[model samples]
Target: MDKHTIMQYFEWYLPADSQHWKRLAEDAEHLSQIGIGMVWMPPAFKATGLNDVGYGIYDLYDLGEFDQKGTIPTKYGTKDDYLEAIQALKQHGIRPIADIVLNHKAGGDELETFQVRKMNPTNRQEALSEPYEIQGWTGFTFPGRQKQYSDFNWHWYHFDGLDYDALHEETGIYQIVGDNKGWADQNQVDTENGNYDYLMFDDIDFKHPDVVAHLKEWAQWFLETTGVTGFRLDAVKHISEDFMADFIAYAKTLQPELYAFGEFWKDDIDTTLRYLDGTNYQYDLVDVGLHMNLYQASQNGADYDLTTIFDGSLVQIKPQSSVTFVENHDTQAGQALQSKVEDWFKPIAYGLILLRQEGLPCVFYGDYYGIEGDFAQPSFQEDLDKLLYLRQHYVYGQQTDYFDHPNCIAWTQSGDEEHPQSLAVVLSNSEAGWKRLDMGTLNAGKTFVDYLGRCADKIVIEEDGWASFPVQGGSISAWIEESI
Candidate 1:
């Protein structure tokens, strides 16, 4: 199998307009200029019928062609507009990875029907049919306690500004209540259930064969139509593991090289590895625990040692598993660890992960340009230059070596036969003025250059055969020169 590296741009907050298509085309061109190999675009389907996050999906087939956002006129362009963006990326040698949400659909339509029940007191039983509550994270809670919607207002909707339907005794679908309440007057659903309103989203029954077939068809259509190289599965833990295994296997048949990874959202390495066991790692996963460790270490001003974290979990992962990125859209920002984007820890984290030999490395879009506040205003051109250059020139097709170290972490990458490029990176977050370390395993008495700062240091082997050097405080990283 050919190894691939990724420089991901999470276009999550991209505007839902025709202008965005042009902007994305420009962005794809820019990424290619900077040597980014893969670009990950956010979900482009219809909005969840609630927020603009795109995760709250209403219909999988509709790519935002509703009455409200008439912006996406098929007359303006067909799915071809998106394909053009992908083609532009391919022209620049950049692969496009689409971020997909297969777990659930926005239960908005269900909530709307439930609201009608509460307004009319004539048919109280229909309004009070089967009431179900959401049992996951909704980003809100009442003071002094944490509970589902059932624990709170039974009548209010949790997440949607509609009412929950009373369960029908015969069919599983909740019965809708009819009332004279105006659609605008319906209260916004709290993250919790209502006391009087009774609004809960209709969760997708993954156990249903029709639902599974629908998901597979959607995946097949995306791959066959857009020529998307891979997928980043959202909220995989919420759905059945078997469903994912089958879905991934089916997707690979369409595009054999397609890489599908999921966000399992667990800290335990064993638990995370379980999802990959039977499937030959068809569903690769990001290392959320290691990401958290790096963030925590940066905040404490401690040396960010990549080896320590890898030693704890790398053995458990499949050799071809995915292993890129420290901070993603879902995690805390890299700037959250410190106020500055140029913080030593940030570069060190990037260098170590990008040069590692194990899993493919991923570069977050915001991390490329020090995006501080909101993702909406992210600047992508600046920091991406250095990273994209390094990924292409040094990291791509290179064999990785994890150098032995305590406080300082280091790695070296040697390019393939056709591309004889090599680079070594060493990072120390310690405050010590100077530190000496062994580089005997690498070429002795050879000159090594730092890629980021352009500083060069000559390796000198002492009488005892140990390479020593001065490692400064904050963070220091160096890459060795290689025959191009």
Candidate 2:
């Protein structure tokens, strides 16, 4: 069908060596074989140090080529090595979705310009303007007592500490406090008014015209060079809503069909929909909050009953808007399909998402074959291939109808207008080995087959048009009528 398929890449997956590049290319091939139409690679731009997670960027143009241990990977060959991976994916009909980090930067007053301003010994106002803060979530504990910008040492500015005000234009240095050394690190600025530090890494003054231009430049380059299908804008909430509108508008000029989605972390429907209104929502957001409900129900041994999540107030959104995902890098790892409780839970979860009407469905790499690692693992090509085949033939590009019952939750997906035959899925949330479902209006006296297990069963529709059958042990499926 016309469903948008995406594969998420964790930050730790990108290797720093040539051997790693080869392995990554092979992984891309595996995903394409499994019917994945798009791949979202983690951030690969330049960074300050060994940031296994690439959110902390150092330069926009540099593609992490300092060294294997360092950000750059000349050791991994050259920039060409990276491009080869992208091209290889394209050959397999998979589009690349680059994860852009436009939020914050690393802190250290090592650059000469920033250090001069911090130690200005003269006017301190100019020093406070430097990009001083690190993004909040890194788990560093900065001393609360060192409040003044001058009192703190700049070298101590690590991933754990945040310095919100550290810019000094007079000295052209980013003034950051050091914890142990009692000195400030001086940072140099490449742009006029020492604005590069603010624009490239830290939260930029989004209202500034220059900031808008800088973002546009990156978008243009990305579209022109990589031919990426879309972007997963990182930290979009931190930027002003107005700036997002303007930036997306400019990006359209480069590729009119380019899809862009923002990461707005919230579970409530109203709160999530608020960000989607009045903006260029070509591809708006992923209903993470709704996914959470389904995930919780699965984990709680509710047998993947997805009624509460699907039956919630329907969000009136563009057909291809929101991106739906069960579990991502930030959330708890999805349950292993090998585990009895989790095995049936995943397929049922995918059933709910892929058969839904609102957004495109995303399948986490780990969910395919129950990989247990945090980030990278060997490919699950066999399982993924079968699942994708089923998704493309059955659920993808289909119109969905949702139904709910106290004992079970089910949905019907029909082919497009031209081909209307449909598949119905009913999931039982009981752990007593099996549960019976009354199929209302489902055709009776026809042979039905479970595609996953290749099991065949007869559907005997009663006089009341109800079909009763014991759902396969700990599993869900696409039940197709033999007559149709």
Candidate 3:
């Protein structure tokens, strides 16, 4: 069973120091022991500053090497430390994935004066402020790094627009205009604010040939430098689909089997499919649609359509293209997208993503290691290890979905020759009751044990290849063969 589980190894509020890499390397054996196929480590590149998350990307070439951006190493750790961690993970049979942020750049070394028109916040298409001169943080000389890997510099011409005008002390979406420069045209984004192009300051114009060449060049160089197995393209919806496809294609040239995936980050299935289709389905996308559905059900409880958990979701439409996940760093606490699934429904969400036969599931480090923030409590980490164990072994073979129950739904996986780990997964959002499932006749004589050890009772299958079990209210259970 070639199932691969990617662990999102870092959260937003992690300690902003140089110990993360060493810690990850130290935990490599344990992670591999727990069956982690890949580790989606946080941005190794230097950010706006030492403490800033890698999303505010400053130097793509500098993986915590130079003493720029007010620090030598990244928030995670130093360059050599990161490399050591990658080596450890690889040695432990776990691949490392590098997070790539190409949509925008921030914390420039110099500010340049430029004329820009401000767009309405509600309606980004309409320019409110007339073209005015303001010093924009668009110039990046990379003085500290001294353009080691690639000396290609960045300026206003390399970007389409920005959000702030430092000279005016004002901030709004501004599309830098000139003979041929305004912003990325209407073709390159979701139609949220008429044109969702200018997301942040100094939005890199993918349309620029120089920018495209440099990004592609940097991608190959980064892959070679870090020896990463693949990439997690960040905020891909903000960039042009064409550019993303081209860039991934170029990176694949260096490593054809590179496991590239994108963060399209749309809740609508059609929009997501359009994006996938637009990019010719070059990379898999995070199943945000499934996440929203789970979130809604978790919040609504019995009143919500529990039977339609996967309804209208990308997983339902195209399972192979979907990468399932529960709560990530952004959704944990005090982040922009903070619609967290309540703790009660976490097991159900995890079961739906992990126990099911479709979609590659990603485990959040916040949930795994217990994330606590000023706004939210520690995440749900208990009993999750058993779920991962079930996924690694019993999750193989044909799947049977029992989505008919409104308050309670269940499924079973008939173990195949490769894995005799047949199991039943039942979840309830309301009051508990008996859920009858078909576990097949292969293990009819053998009683099934509660694999997670949460339930004391075992299920005895009748001659009809069915077994009835008690399901705790608002809880989930995975029952495996007694021998398992």
Candidate 4:
């Protein structure tokens, strides 16, 4: 089997014209030709409205099928459109991955009075007020659909906490006070801000047996309905670790080969590793630590040490379970986690992630199709295609690394028996430099050239199958045989 690359198929600021699914269907063949094995699609269910990016989920059963949230279609499109997109992707040999937001639910249909205590937002372990009755938007009747799929009516008891008190017209993190109600155990979630369970809207209490059973049933229904081969679990750090493991396990029972990954979103490697361990390695995790390193390197430029790039990265610690990414919807400009990688270092960052044989690399949609909204940017498709082509063709076999420099580093791939290809990649963050790397003594006099067209140098290998590969300052150059 050939190597697989995952593409995050949606950006944060996509136009709400309800044509995303159609667009995806049209581009399915192109994506398959580019060697994309999987596509992480945005949330297809009905959210607050057409403007909502599907994160503020209103009803999981309504996949743009019912007349809820003031619209019959989601930000993407109708349920039929979504299923057609999935069929198109599958027809093109691509596995469509559904983005599942099981952390919280937004845009409830009604308000209900419930007793709660306001907790400190910074430290959720500390209560700021005594238990009091407050009307909150914790009632979700789904009146528009009239419970078509499931007769599950969400009440205050279904949630552990909420943000707004509708009765007092106040805004705060209010934890519902009742029998066995509170945040998940500290060990089950990240230790940031005391407890990071309550992120936004009505936090789903995973301990509720009904909630678990319903979610499991919904997973089975979703699999049968959409035929998605995988899931991109969102905001997993704010959810119960055990529940997450169980959810992935349960989903796999319905579809055993279902690929699953989570968004831990922690810059600390220890936290990420701990989460992976806590979940019993049931699913892979996005390497947020590596992204932070890339961001810092982009910001610091030449001053940054290239040798320590993957020092604390999940790819370095747990390569088998790390989903390496350059940028995503959350890391794009104007988003909450606004740490957009600098434009100048984007190619270098992408080269490091795409060409290396470490973790599973993911391509961002914003970088390929260009971002929309206030901070729009042009597409980097041309340069990315070059790297993607090389990744699909030549990035195979045993790997070699040369990280002895502060700015310039190089690596080589001794092509396997089936794929008789060789690649030598060199990158420099400071000044132009060259590295004499050994590509094995199989082809002593083969000519090589820069595939990226950055440097117009063509050199023949020596008797020992070693050549000096050149790279321009602040750029990357991938060298391959000229006669391939």
Question: What tens-digit string does per-residue lDDT give for candidate 2 at 276-386?
Answer: 774545447766665666666667665444456554322334345667776666664332222221444666666666655566677765565444445334443444454
Q: lDDT (CA) for every model shown? A: 0.53, 0.52, 0.85, 0.92
Instruction: Write the residue-wise lDDT of candidate 1 on 328-354 in tens digits.
Output: 666633322332223446666666565
Worst 10 residues of 1 by lDDT: 183-192
TM-score per candidate, chains pooled: 0.71, 0.71, 0.97, 0.99
Global CA lDDT of candidate 3, please? 0.85
Question: Looking at model 3, which ten-residue stretch has the lowest summed lDDT?
Answer: 372-381
- Deviation from native of the Cα of residue 344 in model 2, angstroms: 5.3
Position 474, candidate 3: lDDT: 84
Comparing 3 and 4 on lDDT, the stronger one: 4
Superior by TM-score: candidate 2 or candidate 3: 3
Compare the candidates by lDDT and give the number of the best one: 4
Higher-ranked by TM-score: 1 or 4? 4
Of candidate 2, the 10-residue stretch with the lowest lDDT total is 182-191
Candidate no. 4 TM-score: 0.99
lDDT (10s digit) by residue, model 3, range 241-357: 888898888888898879988888899998899889999888999999988898898899889867888887888999999999988877876889886888888878988888888
